[model samples]
Structure formats: structure tokens, C-alpha cells
Target: MSKPTPLSGFPEWLPAQRMIEQNVVERIRATFELYGYAPLETRAVEPLDQLLRKGETSKEVYVLRRLQEDPGARTDDSLGLHFDLTVPFARFVLENSGKLQFPFRRYQIQKVWRGERPQEGRYREFLQADIDVVDRDNLPFHYDTEMPLVIGDAFASLPIPKATILVNNRKVCEGFYRGLGLEDPDQVLRTVDKLDKIGPEKVAALLVETAGATDAQAAACLKLAAISTGDASFVDQVRALGVTNDLLDEGLEELVRVVDAGTEYAPGLIRAELKIARGLDYYTGTVYETQLQGYERFGSICSGGRYENLATSGNERFPGVGISIGVSRMLGLLFGHNALTISRSVPTGVVVALPAEELRPACDRIAQALRRRGISTEVAPAAAKFGKQIRFAERRGIPFVWFPGADGEPDTIKDIRSGDQVEADAATWAPPAEDLIPVVSKA
Candidate 1:
């Protein structure tokens, strides 16, 4: 058979890179927990109908089936892998409303599948870190501003390149489309979402050709899409486009509040953008798209928006707002460009070399002592040349190499990176604090 084929965009990390991913996940969890958000996990698959409820045509869902045991078996749970966690979380909240408290705050980080064509930082499968607060009834407007700050803090805490979160409001987007006489606001949204894929010129063409917009109306929509500024005054520029509707006005006001609120707490965190029409149909209020500085070609590594009842049995309302970070996609860009890196390969704090066959037990005891002290330790595999042993530690980035001092003596700990040797008591030795905690890197 041919050699195993490596699928594109499904990048896998070695031990070092995996640790960086874990570090990122841990940091996100820590921040979320610090703010009193409880952790949650939702099933990976949902009925296809549930997945398709919002009419996301471009969302390439991975449908699943059980291996056939009988021909006549049927299932109503025709399932597909969820494209994102927000949708499933909405379903979870609605289904378990009685058990969960109101204004539920949750954090979920898990793998989601989407079958879109592989791009620089996008793939068929990836990890998403989402944090959201859903109220039993109408969601408080403060969350629109608070959620972005929470997400911005998560990004700011990382060592990756600085991120810019572009904020928008769907009511404003729809209002503009309606003012332009576009028959279908949702269709206009899908067209505008493609602005990055296709230029504004083509977006205009698609709206005119497919969505029934006249040339003048299409131009106005394109003009509205081009409106992006650094401050609330951007609203003045957007209104300059001559669109009028209270829904649009409300969206604009909400986004302005977000910018103002973000500036008060975390200055320069969120910026209002008229062009950022989140294509998702469910998003009713403020929407966010996070882009990495110097990696704009990589596209938005995080995105989400407000929704009106993620889980609706037709009557009950569960409005919520949230943002989700594409952890895997961000890591891909981070590692590819050396934006995030680790300093070591293995977690070995110290590796003791056997001076002779007779001295093996002493080395084992020392290593075990370190382990008991909550330090990482490894004993040399077998009796080998001292040079070879030092090479072993060096190869794995094991900083400390312990050698039998002299004729069955204590030992010495050598800093491999600095090449500094220090005589110490192997029984109760302590490495430098950072040395005890090994630095991680990208593969």
C-alpha cells in the first residue's frame, strides 16, 4: 500500500506543542473560573435538523451513522458533529432550564468539526474555547460590553501576537439592508459575510444579482459595509451613509456602549465596526470577530455574537450573548510563525546518571526523592559513558544532570542551558524555581 496520507489543515503537535496548547487551555479555564463561570461539556453531535435550524448553508456539517447491524433499523436522531459549542450550549440550557440557575455563566472548551475547505488557520476539526452568560429571560445589556472584555483578557494574557476584536451589531446590519430595500435581510447578511472571501465589489454584485438590490441600493450597502473606525464617532460616519431605522440605531448605540465600557475597564479592547456583519442568523445584538496583529491573512481566530433564545420550544425565551476563541486555529498561526514557543522538550527536572553498576540504586533513590518532592526526575536507562549520559540529558533538554561525585559520593546538579555546575545534596536539593517548572515550547 502507499504511504499514509497526511490530511491538510489537520496539524498535530508533538509533546512540546501539545503542552503549549494545554497551557493555553489551562489559562483560559483559570481566567473563566476567576470570574465565577462554571465549566461545562456538551455532546459533540446534535440532530441535523437542530444543527440546520438557523439556515447556515456554508456550515459543512459532518454527519454520522452507526455501523449497520440490521437493514430495517431507523433513527430520528440523525446526528452531525456540531460546528461550534454555542449552539449546543443553547440547547443544553433550554433542555435543563429547571435544574440550572438563571443568568447561567458557562465555559466550554472542546473539539468542533466543520468541513469547509482548509485554509491557513482553518481546518475540518479544531478546538474552540467559549464563555457565555445566558439569562432565562431577556439578557442584560451590560453583558454585551462585559463579554468582550472577558475574552480580550484571555487573549491579552497569552504570549501570542496582540489581537484586535472588531465589534458590530446585527440589528444595525439588518436595518441598513432593510433601508436599502433589500427584500431579504438574511440573504444580505450572507452576502456581506463573504466580503472577506470576495471583495466589496463582488459582494455588491451578489446582492444586486441574487438578493434583488438595485445598483444604488447595493452601493449604499457596500458603503455601509466599508464603515470601520477606532471610536464611537464611527457611528457618526455610519449614519452618514443615510440609512434610518430604530433597530439599526439600537444596534449602533449598543456597540458604542461596548466601546465606551471596554475603554473604561480595559482601554482599547473593543472597537466598533460597521462592516463586521456576523453572518450567523441567530446573532441579534453585538457581534465580535478577533484578528491577530501581523497575522491578518490568518483570518479571525475568534468570533461570536448575541442570540435570541438558543433553545426555543416556541414560547420560552433564553436570550444570551457570547464569544468563542478558535484555540486550534490560533495555535496553528502562533506556532507556524514562531509567535509562541517553548524552551524544552521533556519535563525532566533532573536525570541521575549511574556512576557504576554498583551505584545505580543510589541514583534511583535520589531521583525518587525528587519525585516525592513533587519534582520531575528520571534515572539513566543503563550504565553508559558520562559523555553519553550528559548527551541524553542535553538531547531531551533535561537541565540537571546528576553524577556520582566521587567513589559513591552525593552528586552535582548541572544547568544544561547555562552550563553552570553546582555541588549540592541530592537528598534535599532544590532547583531554581523556574528550573523546577520546565519551560514549554511549540514543536
Candidate 2:
């Protein structure tokens, strides 16, 4: 037999670490449900064509096939593990459009696979917590504003560091580039999106070589990307840039609406960051990227955008706005830094001590009573000396140990950590609220 080695990009957490992850997920799920979003789950694989229809994600799709299938079978309709929830959701909406109502809102928490090089906060397989609102035909612009507020509330409920959501509208970038007389706005956006990675000098060169932009036009594009504001004042800043176009004006108005809404509701949570050109071709309106306050270099721990035409049924269009929390990425960074604490490694609150194998039935009854009252309890694995039994509870961090009464005496319990043993009844005894379950908190 060989020792097991870890796969590079797949993350596996210890029990204490997993408790923190579960706590974070529950908080996010509760926040999503509080905002009227219903839960949803989609199949893990989608047709490769549908997964590749939206962006430059073709390289990231993990294609699937049956090992015993014919080798010469047609591969055009091959299936691949979904890289993100949005694409499968779009396909789901289109497939079930007739049964679904208008303005469908859903929150999905599932593992998505991507074939990419692993890093500190990036993984080949990861969990994504996503929320999206899709409407028939014309989707309201206000949904764009609503997306970040929900995300803000979710992050607020977590134990992680504060998350700042950086927002921008595609129309703003495309219109600004067109206003500067650049013919290939999309190419320019794709180039500028790498500004953080390649820097301004390299991005400027790529703009000229790839997007066919003149030096002055590339400078204007860079200038637009540099505009970031905490409020609607960004509207005036863009105006000051001296570029004029109707689409740019429309985008500015939409972005200001989002920023203003964020200000009134979740102040200091959202910002108009012009450089957040999401590297997806499907995004037609506002885009978002979230940065954990001190872990900015790890890149966006949450991201998504508004796509007006990702799902279509002939003349009908299902436009939507969404955001996804990179659950694995955030946990990876936090766990790597030892930023979370768990009160206990296991959820057990009380361990019914076994005095003898003959009294196992009595101990089982005591365990059932504690569980009936909502206290997580387990019976001792073996009948051992009282001292050995207490050591067993302490080893697993179980707070209380119960001893069954013998010879008509009342049963008793012990708080092993404090050595506080007292006569008690299994039917009436209960631990304090905090000790009933494992508590997860910031270290």
C-alpha cells in the first residue's frame, strides 16, 4: 500500500475547519432566504457547447465521458462539468421556461469544477453560493442594484473580513471606448481587464496591438478604467473625461442608480469601480467583483454580472443579474491564515458514560432522553473505569458526562472540563445554550 498524497487543487478541511465552513455557509444561506430567494440545485454536467457559449471558459471546462462507450462516437454533444452555476442556470431557465413564472429568483450552493492551475484562493473544484434574478423579456435595472445589497447582507453575517463590492457597467466601458473612436470595444475591454495583472504599460501595448487603438485612444481607455468612486459622484467624474455617447450616458445613469441605492441601504459596501470589466462576453450591463479587505491580492472572492441575452428562446429573452460567493476561495484564505476558531471538534455536547457493559441499555435510554430535548448526545463506546470514561469525553471535547444511577440512586452528570459533578436527571438536565453545539467564531 502507498501513502495517500493530496490532489493539487482539491481542498479538504479538518473537522474543526469544516465546522467553520459549514457555519459560514449556513449564514449565507439564511441571508439569501431572508431576501426571498428560493433554493435550487442543478446537475453537475452540461453539454460542452452550452458551457462554452458565454465566455472564454472553454479552457476551464472538464469534459465527461463514459469509459466503456464507443471510442468513435460523436463528440460534438459531449458533456462537461460546469465551471459556474450561471451557465447551467441559464440552460435550466430556457428548458423549463414554460413552467416557470416571470422574475424567477434562486440561490444555488454547489461545487463547480474548473480546469485551472491551483493557487492560494483558486481551485480545480470549489463550492459557489450564487443568487440570480431572471425576468421574462425586459428585466428591471433595479435588480442590478438589488444584487449587491443581498451580497452585502450575506457577507455581513459571516465571520470573515468585510467585503467591498466593486461595480461597473459594461455599457459604460463599451460606450466610453466607442466615444474615443475605438472600433473594437470588446477587445479593448478584454485587454484592460488584465490591468491588475499585467500593469498599465503592458495593457496599453496590448490595446494597441490587439484592439487596434491609437496611443491617445488607449490612454483614454486607461483613464476611464482608473475612475472609481464611493458614490454617484462618479457620474460627474466620467463627464469630466469629456467623452460623449448616448450609450455611455445610459450606462452612467444605471450605475448611479445602483450606487445610490447601495448608499441608501448598505452604505460603504458598494463602489463604482470602473476597472471591473468582468472577463465574460455574456455580461451586457453591470458587473461586480468583491475584495476581502486585506486579501485583495488573492483577487475577487465573489463575482458575477448582468447578462441580458445569455438565455433566449427565439424572440423571447431571459435577462438576469447575479453574484456568486466563492465559498472555497474564501475558506481557503481564512483557514490558511488560521482566522477561525471552533469551540469543539465534534458536535456532541454530552457523552453518557458507561459504567458497565450490563448497564448499556440504561445509558442508551439516557442518550435518547438528551437527544429528545435537542441536546446532541452520544453513549460512551466502551464500559470502562470512571476515570477512563471521563478521559474519553475530554478527548473529543464533549462538555458533559452522564452516569446512570445504580441501586435506586438518582443519576448524576459531570462538567468534565470544570470537574463540577452533581446529582442530575437525564430527563431534566441540559447544558447551557452555547455548549449545546459547536460554536464557530473569528480567532
Per TM-score, the best of the predicted structures is: 2
Candidate 1 structure quality by residue, lDDT tens digits, 99-152: 999899999999999888997778889999999899977888998888878888
What count of clashes does model 2 give? 0
Superposed by TM-score, candidate 2 places the C-alpha of residue 65 at a distance from the truth, in angstroms, of 0.9
TM-score of 1: 0.95
Span of 10 residues, lowest total lDDT, candidate 2: 334-343
Steric overlap count per candidate? 4, 0
Best by lDDT: 2
TM-score of 2: 0.97
- Encode model 2's per-residue lDDT on 1-443: one tens digit a residue: 79998899999888888888888999999999999999999999999889998889989999899989899999999999999999999999999999998899999999999999999989999999999999999898889999999999999988778899999999999999989898989999899999999999999999999999999988888889999899999888899999999999999999999899999998899989999998889999999999998899989999999999999979989999999999999999988888878888998999888988998898999999889999999999999898998888888888899888889998888998898989998778889999988988788
As a whole number from 0 to 100, the lDDT of residue 203 in candidate 1 is: 91
